[model samples]
Target: MALMQSKSKILIAGGGIAGLATALTLHRLGLKSITVLEQANSLRLTGACLTIWDNGWRALDAMGVGDTLRREHTQLQRIDTLSTTSGLTKCIDLQHHEMRLVQRKKLLVALAQALPSNTIRFGLKISAIHQRQDRSSIVTLEDGTQISPKVIIGCDGVNSTVAKWLGFGPPNLAGRSVFQGLGNFPQGHHFQPKTLEIWGNGITAAFGPCNETDVFWYLSRKSLSSDAEISYNSTILQEKARHLAEDLGNKEMVEVIKRSTPNSLSLTSMKYRYLWPFIAGKAQKGNVTVVGDAMHPMTPELGQGGALALEDSVTLGKCLAEVDLEKPAEIEAALKKYVEHRKGRAFEIGVQSSVSGILQSGSWWLPKLIRDKVVFNRLSPKMLHHTGYDCGPLQILS
Candidate 1:
C-alpha cells in the first residue's frame, strides 16, 4: 500500500518514543506522509525512571517543547554518590547539572497526544523488509500486507526484526538485567527524598523524584541467567530485595522493594553493534537505516539510550528531508553525510554506557575506587562531548 502522493512516503516501524518522535520531527520538516506500524494494540513503555540530561533537554528544545517536559518533571539538581554500607554521603557536591527525570508512561502519553490519531497504525507487526538495489525498500507486516516506502526506519528497538531482515541481527548481550520499580512514600515514615545515586562496592543504585509524591528507582546486576529466563516470581523478586537491602542501606530502597508488587518491576539488559559507518570493521546498510536500539543500543549506565535515539531520529529526518526524493544517489549522498556526522559519536556513547555499567556492576575494590575517586573526580560536565556539543543537523538539500 502506498500513500498515493509523490510527497515521499515513509514507513516508520515501531511507535515507541523513538519512532513517534521521528515521525513528529519529520512532519515538522514538512515531510507529511508517514505510517507508523506498532506491534502492540496499545503503547507499552517499560515503567521506570528516565533521566533526560541537559544534552537531551537541549535537543527537545530544538523539537520545540523541552519546557513542556520540564514543567511536568522534577528538576534534578544533585546526584550524591553514597557509600555502600551505612549509606554515608561520599560525594556530596558534584555540581548538580540540569537534568529532568520523568516517568516513562507520562512521556509516552505526551508523544501520543501530540501526533494525529490516524498516523499511528496499531497492531501492525513488521515481519520483514525487502531492500532493493535501487535504494528503495518495501516493508512487510506479519499479516502479509506490503508497503513500498521511499524510506524505512527500523525503530522497533532491541529485538528488531527490521534489522535482521536487512541482514543485521541482534548485537552481543551485555549479561545484565536492569530491574526497575515505582512506588509512593511509605506511610508513617518520611522517605529520605533526594535525586540521589548510591554506589555500592560492586553495584550502584539510583532513586529520584518522579513527580512530587511518587518515586522511581532502578538497578542493574550481572544476571546469572539470560534475561529471557529470569523468573519474575514474587518470592524470587523478594529474595532480590533481601539481597539488595543490605547494599542499598536506605529507607526508600527497602520500602520500595518491599512495597512494590512483582508485576510492577521492569527488568532488561543493554546491547549494541560495533560501529561500522564512522569506524571500520562494523556493518551498516544504507536506505534500510536503523535508529535507537536497532542501530546503536546502549546500557542504562549513562541513561543515553533514549537520548541517542531522539538525536538519531531528528538527524535522520533532517538529512532525508534535505535530499532529492527523485534521485537515488542524491538521497544516498545525504544519508552518507548523516552517517559521517553521527556514526562515530553514537558508538562512543555506546562505549561510555558500557564503561558506566562495568563500574556499577563490578565488585572489585581497586577498580571501584578508580571509578569513584580517580574517574569521578576527573569527570566534568564540560568533558561530555556527545551531550554538550551536537551539530543540529546538515541542511544539504540544496
Candidate 2:
C-alpha cells in the first residue's frame, strides 16, 4: 500500500447540493485540496423553487451563503390548506419558524459563487473509480485522465454513476410519481408565501411562493403503470397539469397552467434508499462517503434533502478538524465514524418522509379531513418538531 502526505485530499462527484456542501465543508476545515468534478460544462440551475427552513438556512449561513440566500428568498408569508371542492380556506400557518422560498437555480448559483474557481471541473464526467489498498480512490474522468485522491465523496444524486460503478444503482420505483411545475397567476397567489398543502377527497394540492409573481406547485398520485418517457421542452406537460387543477381553484389557475412554458420538469417520487453503510461491494472507504440524496434518496415529503446534505458536510468537516488525515487509515476511520453517526438519523428521516408522503396522499373526503384537522393544526407540539430542526455543522460521533 502507498500513501500521500497531504493533510486531507478529497474528490467529490456531482455538483448538486450534497457535493457542493461537502466541498464547502472540506474548505472550512482548512482542507484546500478538494476537487469537484461535475458532468455539466457549467452548473445550470433552472427557475425551480426550493425551501430553506431554519436548518437549511443555518447550513447556508455556516457556509457563508446566508446573505446570498436571504437575498434570493421570498420571505414566507404563510402555509395553509384550502378545499377546492368547497372553495373554502380552512387553516393557515404563516411561518412556524421563518422559512424562505427561493428558486432552485438561484440557490445553486449562490453556492457556486461561494466556492473557489477551478475547484469544480465543468463537463468532466466520471467514467470509473478504482479503489486501492492505500484507501485512496483514483477517479477516471471521461478524458481518460485519472486523478487520485485520499477519498471520494458521492453526491451525484439518485441516478448516481459513481454509486453504479461501485456496485450500486437507483432503488426500485416506490409506486408513486410526482408532477412539478411553476405557473404565473395573474389573479395573484391565493395561498400565502408559506407552503400550502390543500386536502381534497382522494387528492390534494400543495402550493407555495416561489417568488413574488410565481408559485412552485407539485401534485402526486398513483402511477397507472410503467410506460415510456417523454421530453418536457414542449407544451404537453402543461396540458396534462391543467386537468389536475381544473377541479379546484378557479379559471385563474387554469389560465396559469395554459401559459406554463415547456421548461417544467416532472419527478417520479416513489423510489428511495437509505445510507445504510458505505461499504458498497468494491468501494474504497477513506475520507470518502456519500451525502444527501445520493446517500439517502427519498420522497420529498420531508423537504430535507438539501438541509441534510448541509448538515452532513458541516459535521464531517468538523470531524476532520480533530482527526489526523495524514494517515489514510484515519480518513477511512472517519468515514466509518460518519456512517455510524448519521445512518440511523438519516434513515429515520427518509422512512418518516416516505410514510408522511403516503399519509398526506391518502384517499377519501373524511380521512383527509381528519388528518388535516389533526396534523395541520400549527399550534401542536408535534408541529413544532416538524418545522424546527437543528442548524448544524453537527459534531460527528467518533
Return the top candidate by TM-score. 1
Looking at candidate 2, the ten consecutive residues that score lowest on lDDT are 1-10
Which residue segments of model 1 deviate by more than 4 Å? Answer: 1-8, 85-88, 92-96, 185-194, 226-239, 259-264, 276-286, 379-385, 391-398
Q: Write the per-residue lDDT of candidate 2 for residues 1-398, one digit (tens) a residue.
A: 12222322677888887888778767765776777778887786754565667777777777777787786557776666665444456444454566776667777777777777777877877788777776577777787777777678888888777767655556657676676767766666565566666655545567666666677776666664531243343355555657776765545556656655446545454678644444332232554567776677777776776677777777667666666767877787777777666666677778778766665666765546646665554433245364455545533221
- Clashing residue pairs, backbone N/CA/C < 3 A, model 2: 40-123, 48-104, 78-94, 78-194
| Best prediction by lDDT | 1
lDDT of 1 by residue, 1-398 (tens): 44422433777889988888778777767676777888999888656567787667766666655677777776755566665633345433324456666767777777777676577888988887676787577667898877776677788887778766656646778877666777665443343435667777666777776666666777766776645554455566555744675566677676666655455576666566655533541223556666777777778778788888778777887888888666767666766666666777787888888887787667777667766666666655554456564537433221
The superposed Cα distance between candidate 1 and the true structure at residue 231, in angstroms, equals: 5.4
